[model samples]
Target: MSLGRRSVVTLAAAVLLLGGCGGGGQEAGAGAGAKVTVEWWNIVTTEPLKSIWAEKVKEYQALHPGVVIKNVPIENEAYKARLTTLNQSGKTPDIFTTWGGGVLKQQVDAGLAKDVSDEVAPWIGTMTPASLQAYQFDGRTYAVPADIGMVGFWYNKALFAKAGITAPPTTWSGLLDDVGKLKAAGVTPIALAGKEKWPGHYYWAYLAMRIAGLDALEQAAADHEFGGPGFVEAGRRLKELVDLAPFQKGFLGASYNTPDGQAATMGNGKAAMELMGQWAPVVQKEAGKDLGDDLGFFPFPAVDGGKGLVTDAFGGGGGYAVGQDAPAEAVDFLKFLSQAGNHREAVASGAVLPVVKGAEDAVKDPNLAVVARTLASATGFQLYLDQAYPPAVGQEVNDSVAELIAGRKTPEQVAQAITATAKSE
Candidate 1:
């Protein structure tokens, strides 16, 4: 499970290829020298991305003195609701955040998104191709990615040692055993934001990926069915963990970035680990004490005899897409943000995983570097289920999985619920 130098070198090679954007007709400050306002929306209410993004806005405005970039930072779930509402109302912010999968596809289909293929072509070649995969459609680009990463277990090394565990687990059964050992050592084995629903879905999603294989999930989605035996087994496996009572007390009511929530629980050492994405460490530090050297990361363990390999990755990153009605400055601003110098600031802040060529060096956090390496060596990649599937179907997966975790639904029922929803969609 150790991410070796080979993987790191692989990642370095992937990001070292040669390319900038916003060059043709209008510059970022164009418009008869009159002041232009660009409303940029993103889910960055938390630091260090929040502050770093704000500084970038200021810097952009400073350089393009005639442009006023309005930065709107929203909380995670709230941002989803707000954006959904806007989309339903036939409106969108000038520039907004996107996960760049089914949701982005829907927007493009509805004519709510802009195609930036030509605008970004000059520099898109410089980015990691995998990072751009989610944002591209019909051989055209729809968004500019600023971050890229995967979801995995962020664990406490000290807590693992206290539980007499010498190495991270590589198999599902080993992970369960380690959970038990941690609990026996009087530690809350895992911190989960059950109330958030999405975080809870990661467990089920990763389990499904590990058990059913990546191709199976994709086929299931395409077939509008999720009630296959493999998916049911994935739920049963999650149920096995849930039955162990591994999460922190009141986990069902916990938020993600709040003071008493998942990241905080893991950050304060109230729990040994959390299944989250690359942002986990940053939020943990912001919401609670910095674990510093005690922090460690490991990929999700593989299920024994499963079709999936241990190297398959499950996650996605944040990207920016311009609205159809947005002014050209919106695209220009995205180009400006995509510049290595500006983006390196976010990467250096440990808030972004490198997407730009030569930007990998900006990743200073060891755990994040491990993520980058592991991602590079992945045998397959699946975007987060909630993003990979249509909005309704993805929400159904989250809701059904949450019910399964809450002990209100059987493994079979969880699969059935998801399948039913997918079919209706």
Candidate 2:
């Protein structure tokens, strides 16, 4: 998942990064009592986060008059492209947005990112552990999470009732049965953005999590071996759902947040459910009609005879990573941003989910509150595979899985493609 925004192929170019901090010096701390400018790059060109982040920056600056926070807000896809170019040239903004998975790991490996394990030590524990997983590597922290979320089913209650389904399914078989019911009732069972390959991968990823287990998925990524029985079975299971013709017409070419895309389809009530992250409802309201009280959420169903439990959540969130040589004040600003009081505003706006402990109450939406509760008790967690694996390997997972859904590839072939790419990487 893109966490809150739709991802694009341009992000794959992120693999080319090789850089260090771009502005300020080691002496650029507030204590120095000298003017220091820290360039902050982020994807917050949209509302809620856009305005909220600006306010936080203003607050941070007011507290340290000597420090000038140069905030650079860019659109999501454009930000990736710009970052890729900067990174390829051996330079990065002082403090930049990060997804904190394989992408951050690559920057860490290339000596581009700062290792803030000690810098953040004092208050790092104040964050939810699951939200910090993606940013940690080999016992070191690379970034600080500003928001966190998990992927699950967002459905329409009225549609379910119309289909004669009394409640959401908790098991794989039950889910398939519900799909049958929805289809028989003449409702599109699910909405998918096949044109945006990332959305389709959610199904395969969740299925692998349910059937093969979270550990298996992690081990496969680490071992560069995805052509295992468990993974293949995950693909086969997804194929079973695909065979049901569950998605709307033109789904294979549909976008994610466009007016006639996946979110719109579900928001308009043409489809009963969509497997999306915590950002679904907001995007639905933006791209189409808000389902209002008709909206509901549920955890992905558990697979029979599988190693994973329903409590194993899968998703990732936004965070900030300081460049290798950025000013210490840059790190301080990140801390200020993560503080419970400051972060709560973002959560309260319903623009982001809580990453820090004690901010959970900020999630006021009924459905979002359910997500927060689920995350609080999650037994295991997996960041989105596209962000967890190397850029090439992750793209392969999306591409191969999309092909499988399009009837252009078999489960075994999908696994083989991903395994080959992983090994090459």
**Candidate maximizing TM-score:** 2
* Model 1: residues with Cα > 4 Å off, grouped in runs: 1-89, 325-332, 376-379
Q: Could you give the C-alpha RMSD of every candidate to the true structure, in order shown?
A: 8.6, 2.9
The whole-model lDDT of each prediction reads 0.82, 0.87
Off by over 4 Å in 2: 1-21, 26-33
Compose the digit string of candidate 1's lDDT tens values, residues 1-425.
11000010000112211121111233455567667778887878867778877888898889988778888887665566667666766667888888787878888998988999998888788777767877887799998987788889999999999999999998989999999999999999999999989989999999999889988998998899999999999999999999999999999999999999999999999999999988788789989989999999999998998998888888888788888877788888888888888878878877678888777777787888898877656677788888788877888888999999999999999999999999998
Compute the lDDT of residue 271 as modeled in candidate 1.
Answer: 97
Error of 2 at 45 (Å): 2.0
| Model 2 C-alpha lDDT per residue in residues 291-362, reported as the tens digit of each score | 999999999999999989889899888888889879899899999988888888888988888888878888
For candidate 2, what is the total of clashing residue pairs?
0
lDDT of 1 at 260: 100
lDDT of 1: 0.82
> Using Cα atoms with residue i matched to residue i, what is each candidate's TM-score against the true structure?
0.81, 0.93
